[model samples]
Target: MPVAIRSGVAEPVWFVLTAIVFLVLLRRGQRRATPAAVLVTGAIVVAGSLLLPFVLPPVADDPGTGGPGIDGAVNPLINLGDDLRQGGDVPALTYTTSSTQGVYLRLATLDKFDGRQWEPADIDPARTHDVAKFPAPTGLTSAVKRRTLKASVQVDDISGRWLPVPYPASRITGVDDDWKWVAGGLTVRSRSTSASGQHYTASFLDLKPDLAQLRAATPSPVGMPLDVSVPTGMPAIIAQTALRVTANATTEYDKAVALQDYFQSDGGFTYSETAPVDQHYDGSGADIIAQFLQKKAGYCVHFSSAMAIMARTLGIPARVVVGFQPGTPASVNDKRVFQVSSHDLHAWPELYFAGIGWLRFEPTPGRGVLPTYSDPQAVDDAINQGGGTASPGATASAGPSSSASDPGGASAAPSASAGAATATDRADATPWIVLIVLLVAIALLFTPAAIRAAQRARRMRAVARGRDPAGNAWAELRDTARDNGWAAPDTQTPREFAERLTVTLASSAARIDGLRRGVETTAYARAPGPIRVEDLRSVVKAIGASTSGRDRVRAVLLPPSLVARVRGDEE
Candidate 1:
């Protein structure tokens, strides 16, 4: 069976068989069974289950061990091929924005490269702030053309401590107070809360700096030394390749563009998810990148890490960003939404320039949108035709030679207008949009099941905390019954509902009877003893297992309990 179908079916089958065996044994020993015998059997089962971890070998491909997970947590410098190989388009998030430019929902930035892999810089207590508002972006100057854009994000399936937001966010709302803003990269994260059920809106700046501005801007290493530091044992080929690629370029920006072009267009690199694994160079360490430079075939992690390390060798401050690219555009409830899935997981490089801060460059071919400002061919044409510079007021909408006052600008100067034409062509040549559209429907179809699973986990956590365990467990039972096509009407007493469930599910009557007594005791008694959450979960699992396979599928997909909530019914 496929992983998707197996994951949904395996647990229920196991639990149902276990329950049947237990019931049959109990019935066979009814005349001779004692409380101590039952307790001893349960203890043996629990002890054996606890020892399985030590008996079994570790799974090398587990998430958080060496690769990015379906959740937003990533170890970018290690390996990112595992999740990419999962081979499913699971939805991660959805957002709505009016901005025409593509969006990159950033999760974390890797600034320090240890001998092994790249990691974030150590957290500074003074630099961390509450997530309600963030400090201004580092090194951003007023000379750069930018506009404020707002996006509303709703997390669907991804869960982790890292909060995904647009880069350089100015203000954020709707997240919990525990989420903290790390000022170094303007990234949000939490120590106490998971970013699973969050719905937040972010106000961020959309920076648009023309090629001339980037060329004139000098590289500044004032407060960032780690970004440019290379380990002593790094392969010499990294620096050699960086210098060779940008040898023809004169300025810092041109050098950056040259390196980007080398990887994206000129280097003859191929994007393959399995190549690095097959070739035994899957990580983003110095040796792995040197191998990638030779192999010329790998995924975004290899490409991005290679570019960032290469830029650092050339005295440029650079870092790698792990995040999702702008997703497929779709309409939901008559509103436009961009749906991002696990398949859109990507990594890219950010090169720091003076007066413009850290500008993103896409060096991974066939992966993401290449920013118009980072177009090497366009910058070369503008520099050759014009005086190799634009006025300080030049905007992204105008060409590099827009400042030239020629009455015959449209006809006489074809080379001067080439930069603008190339930008236009890049905008129209988005192939990812069409490919992702075919996947949007599948993601949206499974969204209800994901939401129901989250709700169940939340309720289970509450029960484990001993916060009204009886009431929460009872509510979950009712919802489960309703989802499996059984009804417990509002008018029925707890005892009557339990009796009906006992007959409908053909489960052990004692389990349903015990749950009914617990609910009655919590609701009616002045003081009630605690109800064990494990017992409650066992009863619920047994009931769920009793349903047919088709019923289980429908229950997961359409979940009538959620519909009943919207319709103002208590089922």
Candidate 2:
């Protein structure tokens, strides 16, 4: 079987595999005394390990029903993102929901972005108490007419520490005592019990709010605010894309729906596990989100991560859910059981709206059904006006909900009678404005380097044109030496500088002598001769070779002479 490097085990396994390869190479190197063998072996080892995870042998060719055997050391929760992104065709879990329509079973929510990765703000296993009910879905009440969904899940081959459950799970029964409620993502987790072979029933509330009602709901500015601040150094394309996609959207709800439509429908994003397109974002994380948007192809992780980040860029609190989608249905003794395989492992984005709570949206195509309320033509204007019966899925039965809702709801949607319009507009503009400011700040960061490079180029051109070329070349050499920590003053004569260089760059004495003679003739001889470009090049190359790699790099990048000259010009 091709080694399908499990996400959690990839690092340690790579280390061990590499060490073994090294030891074998070391033994051979000692016996043969051929250093070339070691270098070739090292390259092979690196290439092999990197390509190992992606290799799919005949056995792996069909990852049907279950994943590779699980070792207790791997926590599937943390590795879920990688697993789903890898697009393995293994079994994850199986479940039977009372409703025929498939629902997304969430495992966890990631919140923080440190430019490169998205991780949960905190995971304190101690915070989970053995509670029967979570405080009722934040905004759900008798008024919302919530419907309850019951699901029975059995782990097949996947072994993860976290139990997958639908959002706002009201209760869970029939599981080991180890399961605890985690609040960050409103998920149930257990470190002691792997999800494999475990069975449990979860009851979650399905809140069905009409599109107009959702569009009208104003997210609170305080108390678990949905407005997430974008981190610094994030790619500017994220915010720019978010704004451009939702430019005509008048409400946060509309902007979110617009984004979903763009990704899932009109956006022309292709669904692929291997990122059929090499340029597509292949489930990396926050930093790669911009690339994901541009490439428009990837598996669930790419779709979910991109949508969530875009939502955040629009100042909406959004999160990516790592979970399994409702899978193929099978009949077991008259009971409709959904057989969720590892192949069904999926992710989607959820955006929080005040009054309505966290609403899920399906941005990945070919994975799950899009909610009906998201469809504009299906939305009844009378329903949004609170006159018609609840929207198609509002009754909360276990069936695929229709995405029928006001398509242009945001366009004609009325704002709250008070100061809502101004506040909403400001909220919508904050992300773009912040992005603009950040872009300006980033350009300023490289301003000094850019100025130094220009100054160096200008002076080099002047010297090449024979404007006291030998003297200028000598001056350039002295400045380079000074920048690299050698003390050379303008007051020194050409011969004196050459002597100093002879001591420092002992191997390049001849080159330095030639440069000194040229400078001396140009500066002092009654009849000055043009300096040879070949001689100047040789002396510069010799000086560079004499310096350490670190100093040479710094001299080229932040040449002190050019920087000083630029500063002098500024002064």
Candidate 3:
């Protein structure tokens, strides 16, 4: 480790990672022409972006009504959803006093699957559900003032073989196997093994000749292999863009430097959770590149893609690097918190310099050197700032519920309001404004009779499972059908529930039957437990698959008005 950073240039791991990332992107590009493939890709990205995080305790960065106030004091990042799991009821959710708790807001931990997807980190039958450990002491490294910046890390997972931490990890911690640090700024295992986020501490030693001095020196003749070619359609754009951005730079390093600057300039780049994905269809990698340029938006993947494509266009080989960014050093007693957010998700390009293995270029905005905690003052902001409501489109929860006429009964039913944006106040007099909208809403509103009459049709479903015939379940089932444009009979029996399922939603019949049967079985068998999770899974899936299921998904995903026609049938 000491010998590696003698020259403040990048380590060789930079090129290897770039090559691997490029290969993955190129393969994806090869099949981009197919719509089906592109859609699948988009779907995967979306699902991964959404579903996976929730199954486990929600990751801090996982989207909800989160922001820099209210729950900010609790630092949800400290515990795996302790605040949300406790439903904001836990005292931990409140922080009257400023407590810099030593909790690790896990910057990134993929227990399931490899580098991508919701695949379980491993299918180890004997694997513990939860482990009683932290990054092993050896795994943890420290950047002691002098002797050495000991960075320790542990790889506790077994699904994927990829390492943790982002590029430019100047020094490593906790890597104590036969493995040694590589020039690419990472440690490598001879074979793939899911490793833990080893705990190690290290400091960016003040090597005499820093970046400038090293860049001035010639790069060593380390063999750089083109493990992966640029995805198709990428080459042309890469060349053109590179020429436009770096034509002035006489040397490769100079060109790389200018491109880095442009990204930070008027590129409009950002670390957004709202980036688009081609989950289902396969678009040419070139098309993906084109979309990026036109849209000029996305997560790290996009930024890295654009940079590499542009660099290659100018005849300079470049690759993207994916790793955790440098974390701010913090010492905690109870738990070492490493809070990572959607903001922490980043991507950057590594341009190959003749003598400098690969220099890092942060194409993604809000990246590079950042704080360990997401704006420590955010807690104080929430504290000093009294209660306010949050309205839609407000950054996370700007405040509280502000007014009535919350569009579509959005706030009609009081929710917990933990993350409500600064909503329009109830008395924020919008007399004429409310009057006009109310008139419009009234013109489109249904009478109370209509609401009751509709509810009466899906008469109380009394499953034998000791469920109340006319309870929340009944209402829920009825609403589910109505949402799908299916109006169940008032006397819906288990058989009836199953029979009413339209062929379009035939797949969902099993679910209705399962729930009905389970309730019956519980009541008849006098079972002590409720529907097991496994059984509930299919029931939920069925309800989700039915016509009503489609409606529910649409209503939640898209605005209610967009699906007004479909909903009208339910009424």
C-alpha RMSD of each candidate structure in angstroms: 22.2, 15.1, 25.2
Worst 10 residues of 2 by lDDT: 411-420
**RMSD in Å for candidate 2, one decimal?**
15.1
**Candidate 2 local lDDT, residue 294:** 78
Clashing pairs in 1: none
Error of 1 at 311 (Å): 0.3
Candidate 3, 1-571: lDDT as tens digits: 2112111112223422443365457556454233223333433332332233224443322222333221221111122222222333221110010112111111221111111111111112222211211121111123211121222343332122233332223444444443333322232221322333344443222111123433353322345443223434333555566677876776555665566656555456544324433231111134455655666655445455566556666666554443333323233565443433222223345544443234444555554421111122232332233211111222211101111100100000000111101111111222343344334333233232244334433333222343554243444555555544565655666456655653555655555565566556645675532433343444434655644555664433432222333334333
Error of 3 at 396 (Å): 20
What is the C-alpha lDDT profile of model 2 across 1-571, one tens digit per residue?
1222421223433554555576575765354332333433444444444345435332221122244732211112234434454535566567777654555666655555444445544344564466376655544435443567687888777555556677777799988667777655666767566666778888876555665667786644467722355678788888898899999999888888899878877789877656623543433355556777777776666677678778888888876566655566768898876766655555666777777766667777766655555655555553445323223443322222222221111101000011111122233343454355345434444444566556545657767787777756776677767667677776778788789888877777877787778777877788765566666666666777778887876665556565556345221
Please give the distance, in angstroms, between residue 177's alpha carbon in candidate 2 and its true position after superposition: 2.2
Q: How does each model score on lDDT?
A: 0.64, 0.58, 0.35
Candidate ordering by lDDT (highest first): 1, 2, 3
Residue 427, candidate 2: how far off, in angstroms?
A: 37
540 Cα displacement, candidate 2 (Å):
37
What clash count goes with each model? 0, 17, 118
